[model samples]
Target: MQDGTTVRDVMHRAFLGVSESDTLGDAAELMLAEGADCLVVVRGGEPVGCLSPRDALGAILDGADPGETTVDEVMAPPAPTVPADSRIAAAEERLVAEGSSRLVVTRDGEAVGILTERDVLAAGTTHPSAGAEHAVRGSAADVGAAEEAAVDAESADAPTAEATQSICEVCGTLTAELSPSNGQMLCPDCQEV
Candidate 1:
């Protein structure tokens, strides 16, 4: 990854937000339409929480009615966040420590964008020694097989392989681990859930 790179450099510029009063079903529909894996829950134009598809699924699994359950009742607390100017290394540390796949990007106490693992990987791939660490973990053939499996699982509906902007249909966040299965794009976490 680039030295001294900040959250702002890797965060997704476009993000989705929903009112706390919005129904779970509404949030899910918005996620599908926007191809987003998460939605910030806002009130008075300020973020209050976050809704992911997993949250909705959990509620539904517990018998909550999607159309009637409100975001406030199902959303997770606002995502672990980082200042836009914070270093990517710091953000990476936070993600690891918190066991989170993404973080809300903030500026001047306001929500801005989102930083994700995919962004970090993309940065790492551009560095001169990108393959050094992975090279130690496996043979070239092992790497090739992994890459082939990933390609075979990608959604045909995805606009391009280079488009990291696509959201995980199961989790509602844009991540590099998404794979299409049974017509739904699922992130690795969502796949297990």
Candidate 2:
């Protein structure tokens, strides 16, 4: 498929989409349940935008009315998209050029799947890619761990005496920073790997 050079090559076909009318809370719930970084905001079967975890967190920190707010109100519009036949390398370039972490994968102008840095890494491809990328798509051996991590993320906000940190975004190492930014929990060396 086009020499497998674009983002479409490595994207996951099983997409987890959401509606623009859904609430931020619902989106968060879905993300935690699905281990998704972003959800497609579709209206009448047409994609309009995307809801990302960072956006939701920003809204939460701002004290926005998540219950009343719809995904449309917070989603980023005109999402960068690519055909399913594109090369993975091209997709990596697009992500860097756009300064975006998410890309929509379409077939015949309809949403079919989604591509993320994690997805690319999970594919087990040895091809070279962008400077900042991860292979998060896990194998069968990692499914249970992924599910457990999802559950942990879902229940992570609960009150507790101990302050456990978020897993490293790059290495999945559990730490004690609540949320580790820039992969600091693993130290600079591990993050560079």
Top candidate by TM-score: 1
* TM-score of structure candidate 1: 0.64
- 1-193, model 1: which lDDT tens digit per residue? 4467788887998889899999999889998899877898877656789998889889989999989999999898988888999987688677656657788888877788888866655554221222222211133344345444444444343435453333466544545557878899787777886
For residues 114-192, write the lDDT of model 2, one tens digit per residue: 8764554455323222232222346644633553544455445543424232244455433333343564445243444
Q: Which stretches of candidate 1 lie over 4 Å from their true place?
A: 125-193
Local lDDT at 157 for model 2: 58
lDDT for model 2, please. 0.63
Total backbone collisions for each predicted model:
3, 8
Residue ranges of candidate 2 with Cα displaced over 4 Å: 1-9, 121-193
